[model samples]
Target: MNARQGAATSVHVASPPEFHAVTGRSFAAGTPTKSSQKSDDRLTTARLWQVRADPA
Candidate 1:
């Protein structure tokens, strides 16, 4: 399926963070999959990025 289609699919949204690695550590850790890891990596290259980014 395509991006939009994939996003609307139950598999994507219903995917538990604990079961899927893509959403598990990656999503929980603010990191994406290995393929998309680079995109999010820039969100925080430093270890303190989260401290500065996420106020929660």
Candidate 2:
């Protein structure tokens, strides 16, 4: 995911390993943005959809 704040920009990936790494880097690099929360919500929703879509 790419986000732009004025002239600043950032990218976040929702995959494991890279996901953890990117989240840590984002926090350490600067103040957390509202988009982060939205991302978390999106990830959770995506996971739920994946679970529901799977065949039992």
Candidate 3:
């Protein structure tokens, strides 16, 4: 699929708050694909360098 033909998706970030260790989180979204999912998953594996939180 050269052009996002299928599984089109979108994410809504109402308020991206600053990441705090106690309430820290990451925001990553994309099409339902292995690589895309993996990229998002990486940010949550052990919390590396997330600076903003999603409002969802």
Candidate 4:
């Protein structure tokens, strides 16, 4: 999911040795931003992905 999609209700991620190096912050919600529509450019460079679950 992109940051513009709003906060995720929940997330599950697999642990990697260098996970922290990629994601500067946890995948939690409520990140400071001028606009929610702003594309998360950091994610591209960081090479991080937002994990989500399939609908039940």
Q: After TM-score superposition, what is the CA distance of residue 17 in candidate 3 from its true location, in Å?
A: 27
Q: Could you tell which candidate, 1 or 2, scores higher by lDDT?
A: 2
Consecutive 10-residue window with the lowest summed lDDT within model 3 = 15-24
> Residue 39's C-alpha lDDT in candidate 4?
43
Model 4 Cα lDDT, one tens digit per residue, 1-56: 58635534223222444443544344544332243433457765344343333333
What would the per-residue lDDT of candidate 2 be over residues 1-56, giving only the tens digit for each residue? 33464324333233335455444434323445445664568788798889999957
**Cα TM-score of candidate 4:** 0.18
- How far off is residue 21 in model 4, in Å? 0.9
Highest TM-score against the true fold, candidate: 2
Question: CA lDDT of 49 in candidate 1?
Answer: 72
True lDDT of residue 7, candidate 3: 26
The deviation in Å at residue 49 for candidate 3 is 5.8
Worst 10-residue lDDT window for candidate 2 reads 6-15
* Candidate 1, pairs of clashing residues: none
Which lDDT value does model 1 have at 7? 55
10 residues in a row with least lDDT, candidate 4: 7-16
Where does candidate 3 clash, by residue pair? none
Backbone clash count, each prediction separately: 0, 0, 0, 0
Higher-lDDT candidate among 3 and 4? 4
Where does model 3 exceed 4 Å of error?
A: 1-8, 11-31, 36-44, 47-56
* 2 versus 4: better TM-score goes to: 2
Q: What is the C-alpha lDDT of each candidate?
A: 0.50, 0.51, 0.37, 0.40
